[model samples]
Target: MSKKLRVAVIGCGAIAQRRHIPEYEVNENVELVAFADPVNERAQLYADKHNAKAYMDYEELLKEVEVDAVSVCTPNALHAPVAIAAAKAGAHVLVEKPMAVSTEEGTAMIEAARQNGVQLMVAHNQRYMPPHVKAKEILDSGRLGKVITFRTAFGHPGPEGWSVDGRNSWFFRKPEASMGAMGDLGVHKSDLIRHLLSDEVSEVGAFVGTIHKEGTDVDDNATCILRMRSGAIGTLTASWTYYKGGDNSTIIWCENGVLKIDTDPVDNVIVELTNGNVERYQVGAMATNEQQTHSGVVDAFVTHILEGTTPLVSGEEGLKSLQVILGAFESQATGKNVKLD
Candidate 1:
């Protein structure tokens, strides 16, 4: 039998406990070795459950434990620093989405991984979902022809209900999260749209505001217009005011038909042709916070590490998505379109 890759998880927060740790536990190619968090008790609790070492400081854990890979599940502000340190420590890094708060930080992380000859992957799990995978297949087959426009949205009642800290979560704080709903949820749609259409966002015009939450400076709602490299125009929205629950869905308009994903309760992907034909596919419902599932991020990251292959959502790809969101923020400030280079 082949040896399993030893893995360490930094930040035993909601993401770590719910997705990274649980998924890594089931991966045959991986052995969860250590858990690290600022809170000693959280780390100890997960360590006890998983039969792994626990540390309150990630720096200390990295210095002592030699692991094949590490998942940086820290906050938005720490993503780049922790990922860079993990790469330098000779461990492949799997960082959560948005990559970093700034493009420079994201670039530094990529450079560090490159210098160390280690893989760096971002946890943009939306791209790995079954409906999204099938959507890409249909798009690539030219069945939808050229994508003319798209509208994608991701919104929930806010992370207060989901975070380990509840109402006092770092997600609502500016220093730790940078941007609220835009960074927390919008980035997912940005990454997903880029993957689904195999294109890049070239320009952005946006309206970002703190409309829903009290005592939070970060944006709770954002609506942006994206001009894709392929000349397709689209709108992306992220919000924390969906009190009725979350809504994550996308609709793509093409020359021949329209593709509706995760929109209808009866179907996962629906195709409405310009003619009289309609196609409906049941690819299973999209995963939600309350109904978490294997996001395929850990499995794919481990596969790349073991096979010496590049990850699908590489650090560079993640940086591009981050830049798009950042551009939206810039657009919001200038009240004009911001073009990406």
Candidate 2:
């Protein structure tokens, strides 16, 4: 607890390369200890860059290296297994979003960390976005009154542009990804909306489908109508086929007016009230495939471990967001509203 936290990255793919690795390097409190990936070249590349040891198997890395924490950035299928092992190894865990592919798996991961007494945090970076942070502040300050409805969208050309392997990325493989855009993008917004409004999604009605992606059977588009426990209603859309560009914007309509977050070309948060008053804030830009920015996920994870504090997106929080998306999947299959218990 007094020295720099020894850390290992369990996956060396795009997310790790773009966010976790560089972020960890910036944190003086963390020591880059090791990396593991099924593809030795990928893991070795990052390990060599940071002068850390590399392992082809994460299990071996966890067993051999004395790491204090690990970032689980593997494919969706490996999240539970790797996180559980890290917990059992007495290492804190920072698993990427869509924590696991199933409710049972997520539950087990949470239990593992609980039993082991190690911090288990899911990397839901939207909470750290400048606009999102400001929006939460405004909402909590009672400036927005009460949110009535909202529409949030997250989209890009496809994961081909973001994934390291291009077209053949595990993102397109149904088995590896579990859910496509819904898992990749939808879950982010799900967690964000919940964070922003402090509300839990109670009912979900959705239309999920594989529209234009050629290499995958997983859904490429998801349009969901969510009713929260507070009786607030909203719509969420995630797509990999937004050919023009990415849209990471959310508009929350409240009793007073609408709070627009990341909608304007230059402004980060624009508050437009019914009284014809407008307030614009230029906080910071959100990261994209074209422009990589600092994601605060790693810093939070490290600080939580060092300070012995529960993370914002704890294992339980990640499971709740995952359940929202899973409910969307169920609604898509059954053509009925899927209620979260």
Q: For candidate 1, write residues 1-341 as lDDT tens digits.
A: 38989999999999998999999988888888999999899999988987999999898999999998999988899998899999999999999987999989999999999999999999999999988998899999997799999999999999998999999999988999998898989999999999999999999999999996999999999999999999999999999999995789999999999999998888899999999799999987788988897899999999998889999999999999999999999998998999996
Single out the weakest 10-residue window by summed lDDT for candidate 2: 1-10
Q: Which residue pairs does candidate 1 place in steric collision?
A: none
Candidate 1 local distance difference test against the native = 0.93
**What TM-score do all the candidates reach, one by one?**
0.99, 0.98
lDDT of 2: 0.94
Candidate 1's C-alpha runs over 4 A off are none
lDDT of candidate 2 over 1-341, digit per residue (tens): 45999999999999999999999999999899899998999888878888999999998999899999999999998899999999999999999989999999999999999999999999999999888999999999997798899999999999898899999999999889899999999999999999999999999999999999986899999999999998999999999999896799999999998999988889999999999999999999988889888989999999898889999999999999999999999999999999997
Deviating ranges (above 4 Å) for candidate 2: none
Q: Report lDDT (Cα) of residue 155, candidate 2.
A: 96
TM-score of 1: 0.99
Query: Clashes in candidate 2: how many?
Result: 0
Cα RMSDs, all models: 0.9, 0.9
